[model samples]
Structures are given as C-alpha cells and as structure tokens.
Target: MPTTAVDPYLDGNFAPVRKEITTDNLQVVGQLPPDLAGMFVRNGPNPQWPPIGKYHWFDGDGMLHGVQISDGKASYRNRYVQTRGWKIEHEAGKAIWSGFLEAPQMDNPHGAYKNTGNTALIWHAGQILALNEGGVPHAIKLPELGTIGEYTYNGKLVSAFTAHPKVDPVTGEMMFFGYSFMPPYLQYSIVSAAGELLQTVPIDIPQPVMMHDFAITENYTIFMDLPLTLSAERAHRGEPLLMFESDRPSRFGIVPRLGNNNNIRWFESSPCYVFHTLNAYEAGDEVVLIASRMSSTSVLVSEDNQLDPDANIPRLHQWRFNLKTGTVREQQLDDVAAEFPRVNENFLGQKTRYGYVGKLANNPLPLFDGVIKYDLSSGTSQTHQFGEGRYGGEAVFAPRPGATNEDDGWLITFVYDEGSGTSELVVVNAQDITSEPVARVIIPQRVPYGFHGTWVSEEQLTINY
Candidate 1:
C-alpha cells in the first residue's frame, strides 16, 4: 500500500475539513442559557494540499471554529489561519515541502518550514492568537477569525512559542516558554495584562525535549524536560520523530518567575511524558502539579486498535515538587484511560476542587466518547457520555456571569455524531455533569476531532478582533 493511504491520522476524524464556512444562525436543540454568553472556539489542523510525503496529525495548516452565543441564540464560523506556510502553499497550488514523515523539500525557494499554527487557540489581553509551538503566534481578530498576521510580542519573541500558555487569572499576565532543537534550548517569557512582552529569560537545559505543557505557582514557573526528544538522525533518515530516550532522565526544571536563571532547580522523575496538565498551584511547602501521565508516548496497539488490557495507558496523576527539600512525590489521580484534561479558566494556577478530562481507549480512530468531572475534594467523579457513535472534544468550563462558586457555570464542547456526520455545540451544566445539555447548537458539518479549545466570554470580545 502507498504511504499516504496508510497514514491513519489523515483518514478518519483527523482528516482535514477544507471548507471555510460561516452561518449566522445555527440550529439549536434546547434553550441557550441566557447567562451563557460567550464563544467556544477550538483549533485544529486542516491541510490545504495532499502531503508531499506522509503527514503527521500536527503537520497541517490551522483552522479555527468558533460558536458565538448571546441572548439565547448561536452562530458559527470557521477560518484558516493564514500562516507563512499556508500562503506559500496557496500560491503554489500543491504541497511544496514534505512534512514530518518525509524529508524537507530543501530546494523550494520559499525556505518555509511549516509553521502550521494548528495546535491551540488562546484569547488573552484582548487578543485571540492561533498558536503552533514551531513559530510565533498568529493573531486573528474574532468574531471574524481573520488573520491579522504574526505577533512577535513587538519582536521580543525570538524562539518558538508553546501551544499551551498559562494566563494568570488573578494577575492577568500570561506565562509561557519556548523550546527549540537548537542552542538556547529553552526560553521563558511573560506577557503583561496590557499585552506587552515584558521579559524573555533563556533557561539552560541539557537537551531539547518535547515540553508540551508546564505549570506555575504565585512565585515560580515549572518546566518539564521529558525524554521524548526530537531526533535529528531520524529526520535525516525521513522517519517519524519524537524518539523516546529510555536512558535519559525525565527532569523538571523549576524557576522563580523573575529570579535568576542560575537558580533553576532540576528534579528527576521516573521516565514518563505529559501531553497536557490539568492545573497547578502552591500548597504549603510544595508546588502541586496535576496532569495526565503516560508510561510512554509510543502507541501500544496494532493499526486495527486491538485492545490490550496490559497496555500502559495514560491516567490522571499528581506530582508534588517540594520547594524546601527538593524532593518529588508522585501519585496517580485516576485509573481511567484519559487525555486532554482541563479546569475552569478562572481557577487556573490556583487550588481547585474540580477538573475535567476526556476519556480515550485503544482504537483505530481518535474518539473521546465521554467527559469526566473529577471532584478533587472527595476523590469522586461524575461522567457525561456522548451516547454510542457520538464523540466530543475538550470541554471548557464557562463560569456564569457574576457567579461566585467555581463550578457555577456550563461545560461546552463540540460534539460530532458519527452516524449523521454532523457536529453540535453541546452545553452541559457544570454543576450537574450527568444532566442533559441545557442547549445543543447543531453544526451541520463535521468538525473534525482536534486538539485544544477554550471558552471566551463576551466581555473580553468587546471589539472585533
């Protein structure tokens, strides 16, 4: 069989949905809560051309889908982020550069390595930015989703930005770091509430690792230098990347927010990897980090996804890094096979009682069949399964306007019905996870399974952009 046809990521729900669409009034199944006025936006890859070689899930142009909710009504729109790579390919009418699974098309005159801004979408400091860790973020004005072009923090960002950035809910400051395959392997940066690039500090690491996400306390920032390092040898051989190094120590770098780079304390953990973090905060003498941990990043099942009960699957885990003793303690939070953990945006960087995750299984297709609401206090949980043949994305918690309690809001996600080939914006009441949706804004077209998403309130979106 040909290589392109054999790639699973491009064939199922991961397949690109190329149509750019806008619908003013979307169909709704139930009443859209009056106070639930915000936008649920998600980012995912949608390639413009067939790959010059085999394509990875992350190696494609970005497209953002947004469902705007206001006054019991909903609307939908999607636009591709016009990154440098997208524009170059647009003019060429074909794929010029071979992607992750193939050698780079070095002869192309554009000299463009794919900065497919398709990883995450974050709205902060009044700006909504489409992000891919490979390059600087592309700022787009929404409700329009039009690309306003690359944002370099006034040219302060010299390295690639991570897809996962933490916006300090209390201070309104954004904390982020970038890792590269080249020298100055890791860099930490902070953006002010006013959207100014305040600082960029280069932190030394032994090697370049796929540090997908990090954590923060009031006084310090955390870094994960796991073992899944990018392989130059594999790239030279045109093989799949992110080669795991078993002999390499899985280390975490802890740095004070504004302290000296020389003060970074590195702690060693058992070899493992974290794709996303649930939340983190300071607790007494320790900084607690909650994230989904897997024994390995490698897939354990066959292409047909035969279930392996013995397969080492990802489960929610908690890691406590003692600030005083420099000791690290770890424990698993849940046994469910899950990924894509989230917390209420307002509770970010603080101790919270609730966290949510999407459940996964060994399957040929990427399917998150249900969402779990975990109670951090009692170790209890409630689940909301999108019935059989139905799937959902990472659900974001939207706090009710002027609400007091942390869970007093709604959980929103994009649900795609496999049988019908259509998607819907399902709004689950956060307080009652197992309850029926308060509203279902139906999307006629399939919103392909993607990565991260967020809930942005209307208050922040006062102006277009």
Candidate 2:
C-alpha cells in the first residue's frame, strides 16, 4: 500500500497577498541597528483573533490587556500606551539582545486584550497595562503617560517566564503564574492594583512544560501540559522552542482556587496525542472546555510536512470536558489533521458548540481546507468549506453579556485569501453558524500568522479621545 504525504502549510502556500505598508515605523533603538532594522516590520501569513469582549487590546508586549482592533475605517481610544523595550548598552555598540538570535530587547509589539477590571494586573517588561473605563492607563510605566503604579517580580527578566497579571474575579486582586526548571514547574502570585505584592503561590507540576492557554473560572484555574518544552537557555534567553517528542501524551489538568497546590487532574488519550488549543467558556452551572488533539509521530516543525513515505498516518480528535463533574466526551474526526478548535456558547440550550479547521477526507486532495461547526447536544456537525487558497485563524464568539442564546451573538474570525493577497476579518452572525458573513473587512495590510487577539468594547478603554 502507498501512503500520501501531507504538507502542514498546504493552505499557507498561496500566490501572495498585498501587505499593510507603514511609513513611520520605529527606529532601531539598540546597539546593532542593521540587524534590528526589520524585526518589528515583518509580518506572518496569518494572525489569530482571540475570544474576548470589547474592553481589551493585544498590546505590543506579551500581555493581553487594553488593545483595540477594528476594520481600517475605525480608530478608537485605549487606556494603556505600549511601546518596545530597550536592553543594556554594551561596549562596542553590540547590544545584548535577549531570546532568539540574541537580538537587543524583546519586540512582541502586538497583543490581544488589556483587562481594565484591575490596572496593576499587567505590570511587566514585556506586558501591556490594563486600562480603565475612562480610557486611562492604570499600570503601564511611562512617567508622563499613565504611570500609576509599580510592580516587582523575582526574575531579572520578567516576560520570559510570566503571563500578564490576571484579575481575580472574587478578590479584584491580580494573579500571575511563572514556570522554571526543565519540564517547567509552576509558581503563582497575587498582586494589588498598585502593583504591590500580595502573596506568592508555588506548585509542583513538572519541568520542560509549556502552557499555551489557561483559564480562570468561578471555582478553579485550569492549566494543561504540553510537549513544547523550552531549554533553560531558551527559557532564560526567551527563545521560542518547538516540541516533537513522541514519548509523552499531552495532558489537561486543573488547579482548585488555592485549594490544593500539589493536586492536578490530568486527562489524555491512551494511544497518545497532543492537544493543540485550550479554551473555556462558562454556561449556567457548567464550565466547558474544547481542545484539538493530534496523533502524528512528531510535530512537523519545518514547513515541508512530507511524512516518511512509508510511515503510518495518525488521526486527530476533538474532546470536550465538564470541569466541575470531571466528565468527558471524545469524538474522532474523519481522516483529517485537526489543528485549532475554538469553543463558545451561542445558543442557550443545554449543550455547547465549537469551530474547528481541518482537511476533508472525501477530497483526499491537498487543497480543500474548511471549518466545522459542532453541536455538543445533538452530536451532529456541519462543515463550512473554505475550499483552496484560504486559511482559518482562531474563532471568537462575541455575545452581548447576559444573553442566554447564541442566536444573538456574533462569530468573528480571520480568513487568509491568497488570490486577493490579503487576510480578511469576517463577522458571522452567531445564530446561524453557517450563514453568510454579515460584515467582511479586508485588513489594510497582510498580517502574518500570529498566536491570538482580543476584542474590547469602546466604552471600557481609557482612550485619549
């Protein structure tokens, strides 16, 4: 029998798209200007749209706080003002850059959201500050520009090991998590709105562990273990590392709210698999999580995903879990490599729904990629085909707060169209998950592939407007 090879970037290999051009880009502020010339200017083939309300921004720093996004025709106000950072000056003008390539300073330059519920929640070198309702920054550190508090961390370089402070729903205090060692154990902290240290909580998870997504609900903080382990050098230098190991199964675990630090509830497939994305959404009394699991021998790091011609092919699966009761349901997709699964509640029914992207087995051809709309109750699904030359980013559900049914909400996503040489932001009505888009705004420029983004309402930002 002959095996067909698969290419991970099959859809990414498009004709080319027109990019957003900017005349007033930032100047190289470090020692070696030439090498840093285009660090922030280069974009990827796709960008993610995180599931968030209208009060956050994916700031330039790694922090997800008061960042704003809209179609090209809109310009809004925000509380926190974000900019790139600087490294220590070295002799001979050879600036010491941190992380990958040892480039001077870190340049995330873009994030999804900045929560305004608490200000000091985003205090860190590579993090963006959360904003207030009046569009005023509360934690960012610019003396003349919204500098309202000070935050202190144990690590010399903070962004390398920490997530931006997350506000505690019950206490209004900010929370932060840090990891160390090989597989990477966990450390936790609770901070005040003025950036004062409240308390530090530590945990014994494992080393070399990388957390892609986590969630905080009414009862607990959920963290999932991933194979993407970073070397101590990579962790310290802030370099990005890829995981391709086959010895372990990616596990999903949860931490009770300061209840049991040493206890972790993990779930995985026996045949072995990797969970690519983690998402949580709360409905009545239950918290729902959706993840995409892959079973390839190893993750294809380089773009050329040519499998060894004789290697056996693995399947991808999607799983849903009820965090409170510890119940789970797993569903196997027909022969396709499922990558990203995004879940959100649109209808007020007893079940939930999700949006995922993968190839169709019926085609068996390389180019037909599409999105699936799945219902948790009926156990039925619908495929929204994007055909060829199109790629899908993360899907986000934007529902008016307190809305019971998903029918009144909206589903927003990014679709890269190679033929047009552009990535478009598409908004589809949530009621009819498969309906035509209500609004389609072509991003002025082509944004490369990115991790995630957030949507904030105009009223929550502290805009200078």
Candidate 3:
C-alpha cells in the first residue's frame, strides 16, 4: 500500500477551521487600548468542502476573522462569506467546482471556477466589501460578519473587481480596476464618496495577466503589466494556465486619475512581479512607488515556469518614475524578505514615511514569524518577532483618534502559536514595534493563515452601520 502525499497548504495552520464561532469578553493578556475602538477584520480562504481536484491555496472559499474592540473590551467572531458557490456546495454537501490548479470543467452546473471571495477587504460608501478579483464584490455587514449578497453598484459593475482598491483619504472617493481573460482586458472605474459608480474607462494591454494589485498616488494611478501571462489556449492544450515569461519586459502604465487609455504613459522595467504595494506619491516631476518586488514567482505553477527559487522571496523595493524625463529609476530599499506591506490608511495615496510588513520565515511554505516596521526616510527597520513557533499575517495600522503623527497608531494582526495549537489577536504600539504587545486577545478558536486585512474605526462603523 502506498501512502498519500499531503498537500502542504491543507496541513497544519494552513488548514481550515470548521466552526463559525462568536464569543464576547475574550481574555486579554494585557490592557486593551482605551482609544483603540474599531474592528480588525482579515479575509482569507477556508474551503467549505474537500476540493474537487488538485487544490491551490487560493482556491479555498472565503472566510472572515474579525476582532472588535470598544472601551477597553474585546470580542471575536468568524464567518464564511456566503457566496453562490458556497451556498450550492452547502446544499450539495461537497465541492462541485474545480480550482485553479486543474483545467476548466465546462460541463459543470456551476461556473468552471469558484469565486472564492478570499483575497482582501475594503470599507467604502457605508458598506464593507469582501473582494476576490475573479468576481463581483460581496457586501458584508460588520459586527456579525453576515454576507449582504453581491454588490454590483446598480448593474454598473458588469466585470470582475480588483481585490485591492484605493480609497483616497482626502477625496473621499474609491478607485479600482478590473481585468478579464478576454479582449478589452482591463477597465478602470471610480466611485463617489456617496457610493455611486461614477465612470468606467477601458485600458489596453497586450494580453491578460494575473495582476493581483496596483498602486495609487494623489494625482495618478499606476498599473503594472508584468509577465505573469494567463492563457486560455494553454489551458485547452492541457498545460498550466499561468506562465511567468522572464524574457518579457515589465511595463508600468501611468494614467491620470480621470484620464483614459490615450492619455496613459508607459514605462519599462526589468521583468518582475509585485503582489502588493506599500504606497505611492508624487514628488515634483517623479511618481514614487514602494512595494515588495520579486524577480519571479512559482505561485500558480512550478514545472517549466522558469522561476528562480531563491529570487521568489519579495523584498522592499522602490521605483521612481520620472514623468518629465520619461526615465524610470529603481532600487532595492531593504534586503529583508517581507510582503503584505501596509501604510496608515489616512496617509494612503500621499507621501508617508513609515510602512508595516510581515517578515517571511525560512520555512518552505509561506509563513511570517514576525512583523517589520520600515522607516523609508532613513532606510532603517525594526522587527517584532512573534516569539518562537509563532507566526502571523498582514499587520494593519489603526490610527489613534486625533493623532497627527504618521506612526501614532496601533499595528494589529492575528498570531497563531503552533506550539499550543491556538491563535490570538496581538496589538502593538506603532511607535515601538520592538516592544511587547499592548494587548493580546486570545481567540476561542484557531485562525488559519490568510491574506490581507483592514482596520475599520468606530467612527466609520457608526456612520456606515
């Protein structure tokens, strides 16, 4: 008898939690910040049933783990984003659709692929949207984490929405783009502060690629045309659906916030991929972009993908695009391996001095044993280790009320202890990243490793809900 090989993504902390738990008065290791009044919600994949075929980490269904704090008290809750596929699988009692690792199942009753809303979250126009770039946004209610059904902006959003959208802190507007596998591959849209879908413009690209995220500045939006090409012909030929072409040059398109394809300018850079961006801003004639840059990646496929295993680790990098001179200058800001970079939401789309990122571990799988705070101005960084055998995901900055300093806030994330088989929400002072946690709210259940998250303040919740 032969033993079955275990998929690393489905084992240990990467595994899913079956229970949907809601508990109040969570035990806190230290005093919860009296001023930290908000909910920290992180979104990631949690498949409802065993997958139909070879499963990728990105194929799992969407689940949300949220910790709410008010008046020095804390509560915790978790729920699955009830998508159409989830509901169908719930009724069918098993997975019907295949994942990204397998070829398309055109004969299935449901679509070929499941729209796992497991990527990221955004709060805009009084609604919390659980986003997956493959499909439309699902509106989720806070506190309880209930799905409010799919939000289409009154039939205006006929295409897939980007998981990463930019909400201008000053303009009170949201800017996002959607990519498709078909022609007319890219579209950009903006929503009013009041939540109305204002405009949608088509942007031209040579081919469809898996563009996970982009960047924004106060005056412009930046799109990366990387070499991660998506091909339907290759799928039909029974090959990997995605391929990383190192021979192809990476293109960065700069478009005015309200401009169309004709007004966009393109800049070329060495072939690379950027999964997440820290921030971007305008400085005189240059547009600055800070992000985690990778020389190549094996995220979707490995065999014949032409990826450098050692070069796959993303590092803090910066690129300066000169609009006046049409020349681009790029540099590696830090040598440390990290990803899931975030800045203070209030300072997004503008020049900021500080950033928060998850420091990657030495393990074969994707894991963060610590968090790093980078001082971009001085090129110095501080790390907050989660102790031994502990790991965490993205760290979101929660700005203190009435605080003016850029680092005057809290960095909140879910930390899972492999030694104890338990998880807890850790809160640290943004000013002192190396210090002990301000508080740790021990979760009643374990939280699986996931992707991006956001901090929704009490003021925003009060106005929205």
Best by TM-score: 3
- Reference-based TM-score, model 3: 0.98
Residue 201 C-alpha lDDT in model 2:
60
Model 3 regions more than 4 Å off = 302-307
Ranking by lDDT: 3, 1, 2
Please give the distance, in angstroms, between residue 380's alpha carbon in candidate 3 and its true position after superposition.
0.7
Residue 459, model 2: Cα distance from true site in angstroms: 2.5
Regions of model 2 farther than 4 Å from truth: 1-176, 182-184, 189-199, 215-217, 227-243, 249-251, 265-289, 296-336, 345-370, 386-388, 462-465
Q: Show where candidate 1 strays beyond 4 Å.
A: 1-6, 233-241, 299-312
What is the C-alpha local distance difference test score of each model? 0.84, 0.41, 0.92
Q: Give the TM-score of candidate 1.
A: 0.94
- For 235-337, candidate 2 gives per-residue lDDT tens digits of 3665434434446666666666564466656665433344333345466544555445544333323222434431223334545556566665666654544
Using lDDT as the yardstick, the better of models 1 and 2 is 1
What's the TM-score of each model vs. the native?
0.94, 0.56, 0.98
Candidate 1 versus truth, CA RMSD in Å, comes to 2.8
What is the C-alpha lDDT profile of model 1 across 1-465, one tens digit per residue? 655346777775677887888897889998999988878889998888988756777777898999999999999998899998889889989987776655556676877377889989888888989999888999988788899999998877888899999998889899988998788889999999888988888898877778889988777788999887876677678654556666677788888877547899888998887889898889999888899997766541122232334334679999999979989999998888888899988878899999999987446455788899999989989999888888888888899999889999988899888788888999999898898898899985778888888887999888545
